[model samples]
Target chain A: MERMKMLEWVQALCFVVVDMELYLDTHPCDEEALAFYRDSVENYEKAKRKFEEMYGPLTAVKSMDCERWAWADVPLPWEGVR
Target chain B: MWTYERKLQYPVNITRPNPAMAKFIMSQYGGPDGEIAASMRYLSQRYSMDNKKVAGLLTDIGTEELAHMEMIAAIVRQLTKGCSAEELKESGLGEYYIDHTGAIWPQAAGGIPFNACEFQSKGDPLTDLFEDLAAEQKARTTYDNILRLVKDHEVADPIRFLRQREVVHFQRFGEGLRMYQEQLDSKNYYAFNPSFDK
Candidate 1:
């Protein structure tokens, strides 16, 4: 998958998970929603892993653990990185 | 309790530098209705919350507001990127440039410095939640104003996303307010602040 397209997917998926989180915070007793939230998180994690593997690093820790200082190489989020 | 992420909530790819747009967008960064104030309001208010659920909501929402703050900062940074000193001066950014010199600072479009006075904790759930709800709307309105005047699609795109997040936050705050109300005595809902009155 294209880096931008994949990154966008990860961002949207992460949003869904967090939105459910806000819902659950207010409606803690909703079992169905909790289940869905877990599923969404699982899906998000998977996509995140794929993006990390292809695009290199999303977190500072991931960048540090690598053989090189990959963090400085990639275009920053503000660069409207393509 | 927070982790750093290398990317923005939404991508910002401004092909053109517009100091004019950056000036307005910076308000959302440090202005009164800005993301920094929004985050501080909720994070500070959560401690006094009697209900755990509402407190959690505050924590989560407060954290998200930090991300929005970063997004706004990125927008301002990108917009101001490569802006020549003369270009900045012509765009009414001369005073700001003289002070910061190609760096970003938290201030209103009108040049008011970012101040804690923009938000309050109140220590009362009702008062705090109402303030939060209003904060979201204010931020949303600021974004609306940005969308109306910003001609660049790259700049407008992320502003649109941030605007939508504000609406969602308002809904959550409304729900959180109800959760807090449920824990209060029905007969004296807004009569007093249980945390403060007692």
Candidate 2:
């Protein structure tokens, strides 16, 4: 449950951080805000990599064990969490 | 930090409609403490958060509310799938059917449309975090009400999960409020307000 909770948090965090990154892209010179944006991106990347590694692939283009099909065994959102 | 990518975190399959569940879950979409109100409130309030951590907290929580909004919509879609006109009338979903005709909308059970009056965006970090704290409790209560009304264990599972999230968010926001307050004055910890000026 705690891992699932952390995964949910990281999923939501990645979305917000990506949004903030876009905001900083326009206003790039704000040193403090930029730092926050950079840190958030780094954290999101780390979390995403960790999640993909621990669990199966969540997104497309990520290579799985099966060579013929990458779309197999899609985990339903409510399956693992709830 | 924010982005504008349109992503569906979960795929909701609603081939058949259950009027009963639709009517019940609709309350969470537009209720006094529903997802729409929560999302609008926090997203708007983040502008006033001077501290980076507080702002980040708002962004994170607010974005989660958007996902919650999707989840509620998914639930509604699943319940309302294959619902007939007669079932809607019999299930007391006629008023909603009249307005949306099987389409999901963001409105309270009492028919009050979503409004900014549901929340505030005061430029003071202390005031904003306090409002957020209260908001989470209100949302948690709403989920509790849903849980009480919903008899289906399958549906209840997700609602229970969502309710637990509200509790966790409340804790995080409480920590955020305390952290923000501490940043203002490590000595004067008992003060109610944490703003720099007055």
Q: Which candidate number maximizes lDDT?
A: 1
Q: What is the lDDT of residue A62 in candidate 2?
A: 59
Top-scoring candidate (DockQ): 1
**Cα lDDT of model 2 by residue, B1-198, tens digit:** 444322334333343456777777777887788888888888887776777766867777788788788778778767776678888889888888888987878888767776778888877787778888998999899888888887776577668867877887788788787767767767766475445565
Every model's DockQ:
0.68, 0.07
lDDT of model number 1: 0.89
CAPRI-style grade of the A/B interface in model 2: incorrect
Q: Write the per-residue lDDT of candidate 1 for residues B103-154, one digit (tens) a residue.
A: 8799999999999999998998899999999999999999999899999898
Least accurate stretch of 10 residues (summed lDDT) in model 1 chain B?
B6-15
Candidate 1, residue A16: Cα displacement in angstroms equals: 1.0
